[model samples]
Target: MQDATPSAIRSAGPASLETRLEEAARYALLRRLTPALRHHMIGALQPLGMLAAMLERRSQAPAPDMASITKKSNEMGVLSREATAACVGLVAWITPKTADAVSIADGVKDCLGVLETDLALRGFIAVNEATEATALVARAIMRNVYAAALLAITDAAPGPAEVIMQSRQEGDTQIVSITLKPREAEPMGIGGPSYRALDWEDVEALAKAEGVVLEHSATGAVLRIAP
Candidate 1:
């Protein structure tokens, strides 16, 4: 008797080794960022939880204080707006907007926002010094490569460090540079999300996949993006 059964299904495989490697790198980057992303969501919604409990208690009172209830309602409205904005911003990191172009300054800030808490725990501070220059680059490419570059730089640091992100336009290309500034005096912390920091190879893979040019140096790396 021959047993015939279908094996578990999986998505179509990568077309080439390069494609496989690139996919692997992307997944690795996402795993490394999950903890920080989770923290951000919780932080954004924590206030709402507290306010909800307060409103519930007030509403249940035998003689509800209408004036107090109105004040809390107003407060809740403000907090709701803030929480919504925070969550929406966080979503961009996971699923970027469909627009073909994004502002260099905003892109840099968005990446740092997702990584700031995680980096701080790993003993690194990220500063967005990019000017308000718009670049014809996809958000996904900027995010993945920028994040990988940050991890690579900090991973090489011996102690606390400050990473400054800057961008400029030269001719037909926009250059986003990540520079590392060592901070030996400041103490580094130990508690953070447990994940391997991305390396140069990962950055290269991502850059290749997105058709972006990369220049690596002792200090840092620069990404040259073209429309």
Candidate 2:
């Protein structure tokens, strides 16, 4: 993806939002816009819009060539899917709810699968272990955690990001550890610790909602899903 996170952050600003809204209205009223404002709006919403169109096509089309669709749609399409996944995940379990029986390994893989194109574009190399810590945990927990990790990796990495995930079992728990290697020659100062920490805490909360135990250690975030 094109690091829309920066634009997403800018859009979150009170002043920026007000300005964007006013400019939007101004353009609509005059049926014209300053090139700058037009560019800004395009940068902000194009990915989401394109992704939606692709999704509509996919839903209506039968056995479409997913590889071709994804290949052509590119990063924006991936962003759109990620956004949809996040929205669905939030509504499904972020509120008061119980675990929905799901294949934890499959869920993680599905979430990661969305980012493969972006990862390749960014010149990053990643490997997922052949073994999976398959657990019958809440589908939301797996999706949220894996998505959060991908979001973080995308944000922090500048040149190339290396990702490795290990999955196995411990007694009655299924454990998965994710490790991210940032770009060389500089410390990670992209979004700061607060962003990563908030993502971390959110994953924990997501797991807790599913009655799963989660811990963060030096190696990586450890997920212990009880079967």
Candidate 3:
């Protein structure tokens, strides 16, 4: 998996403060995602470790049962494939795609995959209810805006809630609405390692840098993207 850190900072000589802040926010998002990303990858590979240990014990037994060993081997094979797929999907978030254009549904799904675990820990649930939304837009930009929305909204609410994402096409633009629905519960406490909280200001700066139109509503924020 390639690092998602913005290369523009290294490639471009000097940038305005606005651009710098946007870059900082982008890097902050990646930092915030790192813990959950590592947790997820470790989780996917955990079963394989357990299975290997079990197989080792069985093989060391005085009377080794070939049938049982074969069954365990098959189970390991299935689990290995599943773990590989999960890792691949997670890696794509950081890796650049050959094709920049992506369907709104797919883009939302990918972003949610990265943010969902972290959001849950933060006392929020991210639901990508964006079926039938076929608007094609720049994948990376949309994902950055989505990450910002998920972080900013949760920060503002600071309690148990549901972040719903829905999309629709209006002429040449694709509108992704992230609405917050309240829940009667307290905010979760994720003790220990923590990352910088994403502010609304950060979200605005990121949107501006990516040329995405950002609008805040009573419910949440809306991102307007063009192909």
Candidate 4:
């Protein structure tokens, strides 16, 4: 039988080789960072301080728009002043290190945490009785974040894709599932296996980190999560 692997069929040149390696590296890095950042942000938001700051800011403004909120937060020399302060407090409580690495990571995590919590509290998500609704919203946000990060790192688009979200309730326990399908054919000159290859492990990791079960097959991918 002839080898079906992509490497057996094509020879990659210098530029294409560099691009492929860079894309793979970026995908791997984002996969690693997503869960860690999510956890850190969640931890940063646990303290009442960040919430209090958001509330205070909201109270002061007649109606805070996204731009206005972002502007005000930037003026404070942090993504969200209250969230940043809260993150610093938490970091101090945990790690006393004030190194640049620690500060930058914590700052970014706190900003993301505040943004996520704010969106949830603002009813941007349809929190229906069905758990699937919530999971869908979460999946959408995470995918958006993932796409944006990928673009930032690679200067390449991740393109539009369909994400499947499934929810089930049995007795009192709920289960959720999520899957991502590329909207377009995979690019040529990429992935050692084949241009049609999909990053199944990356998708699975993202879904699992979000507390969803992800399954993929020849037809497409499926995701299930609980409320």
Candidate 5:
């Protein structure tokens, strides 16, 4: 018998987030672009545009061969990375500062939403429960936003930070660990202390949202959800 279980789908790879964001920005710019200019821009961005459409279509299809899908997915991942790099390069060359600021801001927001949705999909798989999946997805999405906000606040903020989720079917519990490494040590500052303190707060809030009990320790953070 075929295993009916819904296997977890890993993230869309490193470039997935950035690529989606760039695509959003490009689309926004295209919309505002004059017909003549837009035609040229669209031609230049054909590869990225096609890849974006492919991803969207693939996402809607029923699960095909896992191995095949995964292989294609990885290819798409590579394409995403390349697309983002190209987009960044273009952005650097073409200064949009004098352009419509509102459109740019809106594009950024739209891109963020797309990225958040992609991340949430991963989070949903990380947590396998039906009732709590949405909550877990929401928490995951918020974590990304929070991390971004933290980064903006301080360029030197410690990074390579990650949110790790652990689940035990036997105990019917889920634990989410948020690991933080300080960018630099300051003389009695919020760098280390704040990170530690925030972990507990985040865990508790996540627990409440997901109907799970969370715990934190010196090593990392954990969110325990009872089945």
Candidate 6:
């Protein structure tokens, strides 16, 4: 496992401190708005919800349309995975002692487990080989990095995508890099451009809030979270 030794001066690029702050502002607003937005959305979709329920009931009582049953089953399965991951993370965060050296790979694995259903449906693959860890308090930062990379990758490429996360230190600079390598030259069945750059500004905003800086690469899109 990598140690937590890092340079006193952390480096971030493209996004300046001011830009990161703005991002933080937006993120904060979004978080506050999410609950209300979700409630309103559900309220607006009540009719569709009722119709969906009717269809689901019909699908169950009879010999069930295998496709529809499978879809519903898959959705429930995804929810379970998400809930389980969240619980594990919460427990980890609340635990008093977790030994001195923790496995960064384990943390990313939990994050991947949470997104497994969506990644699988999109034909994407996530690989974690991060054999490093910082202090227990910094675990949340690593999770955020994995999550941001996952979102960028999902948008950049279609199914069969590839991502790798690892941690290492260059001299006093402790760096954790999440690299995304799409399977195809051009992303298939996605709305945006096939090979759009990953937005490190977004990640920088999160890092800023968490007290960190990051360097984001436009090509290949490596997110470097300084420790």
Best by TM-score: 1
Tens digits of per-residue lDDT, candidate 3, 1-85, equal: 8665667555654556777787788787777777767888999999999999999999999999989999999999999999999
| Residue-level lDDT for 25 in candidate 3 | 81
Please, what is the TM-score per model?
Answer: 0.84, 0.45, 0.82, 0.27, 0.25, 0.48
Task: Give every collision pair in model 1.
Answer: none
The regions of model 2 sitting more than 4 angstroms off are 1-100, 119-123, 130-134, 153-159, 182-198, 217-219
lDDT per residue as tens, model 6, 1-227: 86544442244444456666646544543443233334434544454456567567968684768787677666666655665555454445323224343345666665665555445545666666664554233555545544555555455543456767676656555566666666763333544322333355555565665565566553244434444
In model 6, the clashing pairs are 122-159, 123-159, 123-160
The models' CA-based lDDT, in order, is 0.79, 0.55, 0.79, 0.40, 0.37, 0.53
lDDT, candidate 1, 128-184, per-residue tens: 788576665787776888787777777766778788888888888888999888887
Say which prediction, candidate 3 or candidate 4, comes out ahead on lDDT: 3
**Clashing pairs counted in every model:** 0, 0, 0, 9, 2, 3
Candidate 5 lDDT, 68-93, residue by residue in tens: 55777787778667766655533432
Candidate 6 to truth, TM:
0.48
Q: Which residue ranges in model 5 land beyond 4 Å of their true spot?
A: 1-165, 175-199
Give the TM-score comparing model 4 with the true structure, all chains together: 0.27
What ranking of all candidate models by TM-score puts the best one first?
1, 3, 6, 2, 4, 5
* CA error at residue 160 for candidate 4, angstroms: 3.3
Q: Give the higher-TM-score candidate: 1 or 3.
A: 1
- Please list the Cα RMSD from the true structure of every candidate, rounded to 1 decimal place: 4.6, 16.0, 6.6, 15.7, 22.3, 12.7
Q: Which parts of model 4 are misplaced by more than 4 Å?
A: 1-80, 83-159, 164-166, 171-173, 179-198, 202-214, 218-220, 223-227
